[model samples]
Target: MSGTARTIEFDQPGGPEVLQWRTRPLAAPQAGEVLIEQSAIGVNYIDIQHRSGRYPIASFPSSLGIEASGHVLAVGDGVSDFRVGDRVAYIHLPIGAYTTHRILPAARVVPVPEGVPLDWAGVTLNRALTAQYLVNDSFPVGPAHVVLVHAAAGGVGQLLAQWATHRGARVIGTVGSAEKIALARAAGCHEVLISSDPGWVAACRALTAGEGVHAVFDGIGGAMFEQSLLALRPNGVLASYGTPAGPIPPFDIFRLNQLGSLHITSPSIFTFNKTTEALRARSADVFAQALAGVLRTDTPRLYGFDQAREAHADLAARRTTGSIGLSAR
Candidate 1:
């Protein structure tokens, strides 16, 4: 391992501009930990939220990021699942991935299989794994179910649409404008509608022949939360997984009651894969699908490690498609 690595850290939380590189000393792995030489570092809205202080957990001179793909450079005591030179990808809390090297718990790391590229594996986890739980377990989508996914053109949204379609469920998707309609449709949205359509909700109702959808998988958590509720059938589920349009403002709990006795949940991927065994299994499942070509992220948007700020800006502007990551070099 190198004596020092180029790392990104900021004393205060704010915009992407707050991120800058510094030569930080690299430490060896501790027990059950593996020191990784990072290759593809990922950037997501969650990283933006952390960088902007929306969650406010980072301390002075703090690090940020939790997704990346790399090769194990060293293994500390008790780490038997990995050895030097094994390619792996990992995601976890307490950020440290905005760097060329990282040290993380072996339990949180999973091997990258033969067919999936390291960059693809790096960008796939946050979206693919989230999609996995959303379809397979969150509300247990099936053939008979009709669902709506907000921001359907997004990496996660596309994956959700693709997987839900494969499950025999009919997928309806929401996008901000007409230009994105085709993108969503390509991702398996049986029908796509502009969220701004005067009768978008009515359109959903009409699409389902007034029966409404079985569930609404929403990541644009804010106004979309309420709109999503409207698109669901009685006893429908609304999974509020993100807040790109800003955090959902406080609202009445009885709103659900008023809206057809609906069920709403804001589940996190972390909670879904809390157990090491569960994480490994879910990771493997998503990885297998990627290798099988069921999930599409053929060419990820590439960014230099120093261009982190630009990357965040592009994401915040909604100008990105497919998986996006920073190259360690």
Candidate 2:
């Protein structure tokens, strides 16, 4: 609180090399906001999208972290639920989590349970909330349903697989490598396959006895989006979340009719937690599951705050797995 906070920022839109570390005097939180000294920061794929200009931003010269965990240093007027020294984490925010200290809306921060590690809180809230909505809202998965998740070993992938399994759904996953298959299986996937394999869709059909899955979670868009449609049975749902391979090409509505009257929706965390009540409910489910051990977060890879650039590069290159956290001061 005595000195300026340092953060990584990019003045021009480009690759990881554009991120630079700089310092600025820390400011007190405004009304309904709280100032936190971050203990850990989460590196997500969305950050890569923002950096590569795939996800358009209205402005530049911004810091780049969607979520993090830390203790409250001070609370502004009218804030009551949190106090100084409270452990908390949040998601769906503008650029700025890539710093040692920040001021965020008080409503966004949720008190974390003692059982959840600080670094785990940093990475879990966003991805876990996503899984919560996907399973509970976008499509209600149940014991009788068969769910297929793309990028099963990735952050959201692992969480979705675990949660779907808890709901009694037969959770299957698609990964890029054999090692990732083991990781996905450990995360409660009933079956795991390589997404790039030529016969992967056939394998999915074989698993369901030619019936296909009840739902397909399509994160790798582009041509894979069409393939996901083919892997669904009648009245199946297709949740196309991320476009790591780039956005899917425009298609006709009749394509859904052709593909068993399947339903497709693209969801973002911002729309899921649009209200304070929604945020409370979503974060509560996330922390409760983490506390009860219903969903196990894999050991996160640690990168020093200064190594943020390297972390981004690794994440974009697909050399990193699970969550990547930056240790804050």
Candidate 3:
């Protein structure tokens, strides 16, 4: 059955002010799809990019957000994996999660475990999946490796720090302020330093006894891109994941040759979770750790669904920590 639900959307690309709360008639699940009643939504930096036109919108009146956790209200024909009343969570493209109800492709939805909180699922699903690939596939962090993670108190950063430390790697992290130092340290960083310190890059080397880190996981792009390269040792890997500060400008490729023959990679979750099977596997790895009491996910800053604009502003300003999640209206 179709129903009218309140949602957030933007008629044009602009700031948080451009977002408007409107009611839309949600259609019943189509083939290979399911209708969901959201319990929580993720507030991310990419949502800001979409709201501000930093990332091009395919059309006007575009709804933002891609991560949410909720219950399955209905499932389309031929859908056997799930039924009404199953708790589920999802994070993927084709946006429009800034609402209480939505219809999404069944392939994108995954069952949330019994013990995991829905709000935590909403915010950390994508970030945990991201950390999975970043730590396991991107560079395969493990024992004997010393890694440097930028913005180590942020959503994905905390997960990466904890997971890498679990794998026996020594984690050295950089945060923007002293307030986040202890947070990163609690997340399992052997050492945490303020990024603004002029000697921070040298500090990373100092932590590693002048050898530098084996890998530098950088999501704070733009100005930090070059510093990440400098923080890596000879034959080290530099993985650039996201550009919250701003996108990285073009640079000389020969600089890699001079910078200790460093290996650099740019990874996107869409590329990593390209298949349903792959997505499910990563989700299992994340929740399993959560159930085992190894990985942490209880640190989200909660906001009501109507407060998405405020959420965007806070996230963009770096005024929030851990994860940011929006509860359903």
Candidate 4:
């Protein structure tokens, strides 16, 4: 595996158009690494952030992407965990998954389980793992809990809603528009509210019998910070994980006390799955859920490597729903 890899890279952060194709020489896997011929790459909001300079890259001429699914082409020395031709998926650092071929640390890659499609794994692995931590660790939804999931029609949102519902929690989801209400409901939301409506927070509280929800899984960021707080009950937890709308602005900590001793904390998948053992365990849980039909395995909207710009544009505009992936084939 020592040839050219067709990759999507950017010389300077700007817009989707900044993403361009480049054929770079692919090197053999180093010790503790694995060469992968990626089949599908996930398109996440973070990728947009990296491309738009909201999240700065280390330098110019950077490749953008963090998650993908593919087959192992070669394994370096001392790597017995994976063999050539094994299906694998990874979501980790170094920001270079948007290519036809890549070399990644063996520790960062996980095997895609039987019955899981590589494309689905490519687009949903990161999100599903995020949902895993959010549901099982960050807030720990349970049978007696009532939870609110923002962007319920989105990828992580759908998975979160489904997982929470599977855990027997009463799930209320918020979508940007009415068109997505059905999709949210299909993902196991007991109630769906339009986030655009100013009274959505009130509606959520009303559904919870004026007590507010036990937890709020908010990814919309800044714009919805106060609203998310308002949607929580006394001593409720707010898991602020993403900033797709924009980074959350500084706010008063005392506001939590005023809001019935509410708790606000941000959690990251990287932090939750920091160790190799933790990463594999979490990935196994996600795959088990996927195989058990707890998480839907619907086909995601896919764009070719050449259409990376369009994919970013659509994602930034919030024009697509569920998961979307870049086809590396």
Candidate 5:
């Protein structure tokens, strides 16, 4: 492994301008860790939230990536199940996914299958694993269910839509622009609506025969959180996983009782991957799904490591669709 690598660091929390691409020293693996020469880094909306101080756990001068996939260069003491030359990918809290090389806990890194491409491995874990839990555990979907996914063209949205459809559930999706409608529809949304339009919720109710869906997956919190409640059937779930529109407004818990006994839940990847065994079990399911052709790894928008700021800007402005990647050059 090279003694030095390039990483994006920030001194203070702000907009995309805060990110700096510079050469930094690569860290050697400590006990029970491994140094991965990164291949593709996943750029997520949560990264933007962390950089802007909305989610303030990140300290200054921090490396800014949540997950990546690459080849293992060195293994620290007592490391097993992984070796010096294994292709692996990992995701977790303690950010540092955005670099040419990274030293991560060996137990968190899972080896990629022979048929799966390395670049795809890096991009799949964070999004795909979340999708896996959302489908399998978070208010499980099946043939009798009708589901609604907000931002249906997003990285997580696409996977959820496809998985729901493959399970014989009718899926409805909402996107911000007209261009995204077709892509969401193609991704398995039986019906797609433009969220920016005033009548989007009305469209949802219409699609469900005015009774609303069995469950509503809402990641674009704020106003959408309330709107999602109106679009849910009695006893339906409103899965609020993100707050991209802004923090949700204060409301009465009785509002849920008033709105057909709706349920609201805010979930994060770290909670699902709380234990190494839990993480491996989820990753194994994701890998199995991808290998079985339920999830597509191709079509990710790849960007270079130096273009990190531009990548964030594009994501924040919704200028790009599907997944965005940072290639370690």
Candidate 6:
């Protein structure tokens, strides 16, 4: 298991151009670890943040990427849950998935079900787990709830919308433009609004008969923070999970009380699935949703390992929809 691996690394955080391909030595898995030959790697907005230094990495010569899927090549001692040749996928914290091979703790790996494609698992696992927590644990969307999902045509947004709707919540989605409306609607949004519209907030309020929605899933941070707050009803929860637009600006805490005692929380997937048992339980739900047609399993747009820059460019420019991934082969 000692060999070379092709990886995308960056010496400094800047832009997409900072990502460079290089050959690095690989070693066998240590105890409680598994060596994997990756087939697909996920591309997420967080990856863009890491590239641009919006989310700083600890070192200069750092690898970026948190999710990938492939087959187990070897397993270390005390790892009997997985064997060589088992299809697996993982999403973990110490970013380094943008490589052809890697060694990860067995606790971090999940078995990809037989009918699910490795590519789909690679690109969708993180997002699916995110959606699971948002709809189930964050605010617990239900039949009586009316929720607003921002950037509904995007990766996690689409999954979130669908999962909320499946839970019987009335989902209203917002997209950057009218061009993305159909995709948002297809993802089970009962209504889609153009986010750029000056009256979009008014429209959302109108849709809820002026009472406002029961929950607001706002990923567009600063630009939409106040608006998301305005879209919620009394005691409604605003889950501020991401900030692809920009970090939320500081505002008076009293605004929550002024806005009908509303509540705001920033939820993280890592926190939701912090333990091995929690991770496996949550991943099982995602896999069951995909297998049962509650979550879509379509193939996503992919980039070759050499095109990592182009992939980041497309994702940051908002030129792609759904999930996008990288091919290791």
Off by over 4 Å in 6: none
Off by over 4 Å in 4: none
lDDT of 6 at 141: 87
Model 2 off-target regions past 4 Å? none
lDDT of 2 by residue, 1-329 (tens): 46799998898789888999999899989899999989889888888888878877668788888899999999999999999999998885676788899899998888887878888888767778888999988889999999999989888888899889999999989998887888899889999989989899999999999999999888778899988999999999999988888888989999989878889999888898988888988888888988777888556887999998899888777777677878987
Clashes of each: 0, 0, 0, 0, 1, 0
* lDDT score at residue 132, model 5, on the 0-100 scale: 82
Q: Runs in model 1 with CA error above 4 Å?
A: none
Q: For candidate 1, lDDT tens digit of each residue in 157-226? A: 8899988988889999998878888989998999998987878999999999998999999999877777
Tens-digit lDDT string for candidate 4 (13-60): 898878888999989999999999999999998898888888879988
Candidate 6 residues 1-329, lDDT tens each?
Answer: 66899999999989899999999998989999999999999998889898899988998799999999999999999999999999999999989999999899999999999998889999999999999998988899899999999999999999998899898999999999889999999999999999999999999999999999999998889879999999999999999999988899988999999999999999999998899999999999999999988899999888999999999999888888899999997
Candidate 3: residue 185 lDDT (0-100): 95
TM-score of 3: 0.98
Residue 237 accuracy (lDDT) in model 1? 92
For model 5 the local lDDT of residue 121 reads 74
lDDT of 1 at 236: 95
State, as a TM-score between 0 and 1, how close model 4 is to the true structure. Answer: 0.99
TM-score, every prediction: 0.97, 0.97, 0.98, 0.99, 0.97, 0.98
The residue pairs that clash in candidate 3, if any, are none
TM-score, cand. 1: 0.97
Give candidate 5 misplaced runs (Cα > 4 Å).
none
